[model samples]
Target: MTTVLFVHGTGVRNPGYEETFKLIEKAVHLERPDVKVERCLWGDKLGTKLNAQGASIPLYDSTLALDEEEEDYSIVLWQQLYNNPLYELQVLSLKPGDETAGNPFGEKPGDELNSRVERLNPSTELQAKLDVAGIAEVFEPARDTVIQSEAYHQALQNASEELGEYRDAIARAIVAQAMLDCEQQEKHPPILTDAELRDEVVKLLSLALGEAELGIGDWVVKPLSQLAQPIGTFYLKRRRGIITQSVSPTPCDILLYQGRGDRIRDFIRAKIEQAEPPVVLLAHSLGGIACVDLLVQQALPPVELLITAGSQAPFFYEINALYSLEYGEPLPDYFPSWLNIYDLRDFLSYIGANVFPNKVQDVLVDSKQPFPRSHGAYWTNKAVWKAIIPRLP
Candidate 1:
């Protein structure tokens, strides 16, 4: 009889392992009843722990740090701004503005905007401002993008005779949109490293519209600054407990195994040795990493096929971080036939065929779920079962 040795991923202790293992065992027996199934449950035996109850970490459970009133909100706000150039604009538009005084004697609210809107061409002289700002490459495309965008049109309709304020807001939005465009093309420069250069780009663009960078600062950031303080304090006070409860122990297992993996590899080897001939090693996540390292370091002739699902072994090897093998090193001749299964939605899953060439066979299966969820959805996926059952030794 053939032996199928199942090695589970990180963070899987006894009760959880039993539930997941039974699912696999049932799936396998339904198809290949003649094959004997075994398990190498290493997580419970060798997983890392906070034996000192996290005493080594500074301020592990302390909340006194929240008493400090000086909270800087700019860093987090700027990070959000970098990802979404129109964040401030979106927030401002959502907010309710104070009622404007009746202007019976004045032109309608948006009339002045209609007159000047025709002249608000970002592609013309603004291109020169972008060129001097060191992102000339994205100017035309960015300009076209903003002019055609629904947000830009909406902003134009909302502007009153407050031409200066609206123009300044529009100019900054254009510049920020240009930065986002450059990033999407994977050509973002290192301008943020020199804050002066980044500021100059926005300043120069605002000056083109005969205004300054006061609109976003006075109208948008000031209000957000007030709101961020209380929110930041609430999170700060409960951060330690929140992290303790939310953060998974899986990362600890990965780190411990990467740093010192002798026990995990040895445990897998012992399982392989005791299994019947034509043994197939089926592993997932970090277990897959340990199995790959073991197979590469030493030959186990009884192990005829190796299967990995949602594994980072290939990623580690490509980064030259794998414990047993370096990047560019060929797999040993003694290594068995390898099958790697991946789900595109599972960000943890990676392709090995390109890196290992002919040695590894890569297959894709969709779990129809978003990542983190997709990572664990493979076992329930029918395609995953079909792929493995046919390849079993």
Candidate 2:
């Protein structure tokens, strides 16, 4: 019978390892019942622990807060602008207008302007300007979306008196709002990804209305930048515990391994020797490094296949950091078949095929997660299992 010996990666301790191991164990048993599954469980004995009970971690203080406070605040402010491009216009319209005598003409400026504004078609007017600017694809759906919005109609009615004086601002707001709506829905024809381009688009739309230069959304940028430091400091102070707990493990494990790794390799070899014949070593992260080093230094005949998920062994080999291998040396003839699994989002995972040539097979899987989560996502990913099951001895 084929025996799959599971070896865990860095930073995993008893209860946490038990939870993750159960996931691996259940998956194997459900798919290949005939195959025997066992765990090497080396982390408890050989893994790095905070011997000083985390006395090394520095404490957070007001002076130690993030340095990019203004930049971060600008990002947040821009995100708000993107989500609600009409906010500035809304504010402008609500502010008290200059008191003046009634017009002696047939119609008031507000009434005359509102009539013209209601008749203006975004597709035709905005499209003509956008065409000259070569961004014509953004008009149709954007126009359609704005005209259908109840909020758009309400804003027009609520701000009718101010509309005559702030016609340009109102026009730019409508166009900007339409573009933002389409962009959020992923239907914008052109990628208005840059804030500069978005500002230019608003300018073009205002120009299309035959309006002079009007500072539509410029009032809040400076104020928001000023507010960033205090807000960021308070947030950081509250989230210090959460941030440290989530990010400190992996790097600590790596540093520990670089400083002391012999105990980990010995623990792995002993487990391999005790396991049943035709053993497959399924190792992850730093555990993969130890397995590769062990196989390269001394042959383990019982181990038929070696699978490394999100491993850095190839990177270590290239850097001349792998204990048993050097930069230009080839894998020994006694080494078993190697399957390297990686996820595109997992930045730590490195391809081994380039380093080992035909001896290693590299497979890509999507964990549908971002960076750090992707590193630990392999065990739950179906693509990982499909790749491994067929390669079992």
Q: Give per-model TM-scores.
A: 0.54, 0.56
In candidate 2, residue 361 scores what lDDT?
97
lDDT of each: 0.69, 0.66
lDDT of 2 by residue, 115-173 (tens): 55556555565556565433466555554555455544444444433343256555545
Task: Give the C-alpha lDDT of model 2.
Answer: 0.66
lDDT of 2 at 170: 51
**lDDT digits (tens) for residues 38-146 of candidate 1:** 9889878887767777775555553322221232444334434555566555654554433473264665444454445446555555556566555777755655666
- Give me the overall lDDT of model 1: 0.69
